[model samples]
Target: MLRHVLEVLDFLDSPTADGPGTIGILERFLGDLDPSTSELRPLLETQRVVGDRGGTDFVTVTVPGRRGRMADGEAPTLGIIGRLGGIGARPEVVGFVSDGDGAAAALAAAASLLRMWRRGDRLEGDVIVSTHVCPDAPTLAHDPVPFMDSPVDVATMNWYEVRPEMDAVISIDTTKGNHLINHRGIALSPPVKQGYILPLPDDLLRIQEIVTGGPAVTFPLTTQDITPYGNGLRHINSILQPATATDAPVVGLAITSAAVVPGSASGASHEVDIALAARLAVEVAKEFGAGTAVLYDAEEFAKVNDLYGSLAHLQTLDGARDESVLDSMEVN
Candidate 1:
């Protein structure tokens, strides 16, 4: 599993390859949750820009939020949103556009849009584009190892903010507020401890092999899989020592269990209920070639509470939003 995952990640991080193909593999690996039945509707949106000869294509998804819920028809309830985007190419187009940062931003916005939908929320305005540029590819970059240093999991929520552009893409009737979920942006580099520089170049590869292989791999990560003190604060602080001084960024990782389900106790729903916290930990760990799996507790929850109101008030929808509306209206 580690090897397979590494193969995909290596391609994604590679300067030579645009990130789309890698994302396709990820979508395939994760499998598709039903649009209507599962909590993963807006999880992976495939886009295609058609031209005369050949066009461009790519896939994108949003980052999980803090303590995310993975129930269907839901988005992350984390208040803020995060996105991950990538560009791909074809044999015809040699150097296609690589809008990794753009892709990430879109994903974030998509998550937010979804969230707004569940709340019956409306966006403040039309969709807007925020620009970002990728850090130039590492010059003397070597094959980096991939591992799950910690076991991270995922959580998700419903309710996203759908912008005008996404509405154009899906051809949905935006006027009616059918799809309200959208993501914001992504935090590119996570703060985490960097492991010792391996003695041999192959050492990194070995780590990648073990982590990508999953539990069967013989590596320290599985045996050491557990959330660190401070929920990873100490580890992040430790790893960032070298990078912090020179403005270098330290990438840390953690893992947990997560799943996407449909519906919740709060009457929220999602097409893709991704467990963001755990997923972020796992992805960051994989970037560093660590080993670990975040375990998650999956259970359905939705309980209604008692409601007390006058019979007349109960009949009018306005009373729900403003209780005074009930007092002002006279019974027929």
Candidate 2:
């Protein structure tokens, strides 16, 4: 298990960290550990301490309440905390206490186990059942560069409750190549609308074309879906919180293009550059390793719309416009 942990850490550092080969290597390494051996626990504890000292977050589970929000009047105590340490006659059994729909309760138990086994923040209410294990996920305690953010179940994990949107939700977007117009909206050019919600090979091909100059090239794209885990969307919302740019004096725009060459035939390609939308498109594909759309104004969208089509064609387009001109735009 120690070697397995070290391998996981190393893979995480690699450019293609979570590739299939890396996963196979990890599985094989973990297989070497004897489940029957009693040495595993102490080694894990030692590693946990070492990781913590080396600036790695160690996983710990704390169930402050079994039912309802902790701040609410009906919060219940988590009955089993030390059982996971294998301290008693029946040490393998980690305790669980949940009060909710049967599914939610079961999910909470799993979440509690995950928290105990992995380093993460406490959830607020009972466990949100939808989140699944993400081995290389970024800890909430330390934000990483290149912004490796993904949605996870957020309910019952206490800190998630700080945001009103973290109550219960599911992560809808799988293709990590997405941009936010603001918080909840995504921009889509016409070509992307065809398969926005429906997964299509053509749609993926479009993303590939823009990414590589010719066609889709085989590369790594981390894919995880916690829809089966409870409160999925809430978890995603927490993970995808907008970056606060204190130094930038830039305006946001929503733009769409239908006849664009080599981009997802269906899916939003959120764009954000007026002067160099095309160049930015290439930069986005190359730098972030994702296809991107250029942001545009209402008039620009309309002009593009007049040239190609109308914004009304897009089903998920959030019609958000920067009504204030560049001069009138104020940054506080």
Candidate 3:
């Protein structure tokens, strides 16, 4: 994991012209792992959706599982999204930035998975890795932490990265800026399937323990956290934004630390910690593709739906029409 992490860091720690956004170089790098198992495509025209925002280069890599994405008897495809604004918060900060951990970790997992496949350990289904590249991304001010602002908005990210072919997704992001999760490794969030906040499955907990060789833990989740962005509401971060555009089951993989680290901070990324997060994504992809890891119990989810009615409304940009009424306003 450490080796793969370093490889990815070295790869993405460069300008977009030479890094992950360049489909040719990235395609060549991935082809080295297993040409049969990896495929890359660069989406240069995505800037149109982002209103011609410069420094935005979107790319998606598909690492074939036992079967391809279109095979008749292929297993479910797993989507691993490196959810971040950019790898380097340039012009605002100096040197390579840790805010890019989401993209770095995501690319690392893709490489490792393909490497595993090359070692004759292919997964059951396909694994798709998608993220954008922008070394000089802008910054935004949020409470408790400052974050790397995206060159393109969240909707554009979902448009290019989130796909209907994905049945499950692991959205990884650097969560060191938040105070709620304090640790040195990774933590999982409850399954955000469709629009409902389903309970975290025990199978995932068991897998976490198995992978970390420690106790399983989860980050606290809220309804607002899972809801779509642009609803005039605050969220922890863009970690869960992928769930908005797809009906697939989604989980957030947070790379945490004991200290409240700002996303814009440089030389703050812990190689070991990022490696752990990447490994978690890799392991989940293996389990999920093999049909051995259940993110949530189907029967239980159905029972909750029957008893409580549909919660899919929460997936909308504006949730619960009555909640939008901010009527009782006064100045003291």
**lDDT order of candidates, top first:** 3, 1, 2
Model 2's alpha-carbon lDDT is 0.23
RMSD of each: 21.7, 22.0, 6.8
Question: What are the per-residue Cα lDDT tens digits for candidate 2 across 1-332?
Answer: 22322333333323232223332432342234447854212111100111111111122222332233443524322211100000011111111101001111122233323333233333323222121122233312211112222222222221211223222111112122223222212122221111111122343345435533453322111111111112222222222111110111111111222222111121222312111222222222222211122211234434554676532322111333222222322211
Evaluated with TM-score, which candidate comes out highest?
3
Q: Give candidate 3's TM-score.
A: 0.87
lDDT, candidates in the order shown = 0.24, 0.23, 0.76
Listed in order, each prediction's TM-score against the native is 0.24, 0.18, 0.87
Residue 330's lDDT within candidate 3 is 18
lDDT of candidate 3 over 8-42, digit per residue (tens)? 77767765433334445444444544337433322
C-alpha displacement of 101 in model 3, angstroms? 0.6
Off by over 4 Å in 3: 16-53, 319-332
The weakest ten consecutive residues by lDDT in model 1 span: 150-159
A best-first ranking of the candidates according to their TM-score comes to 3, 1, 2
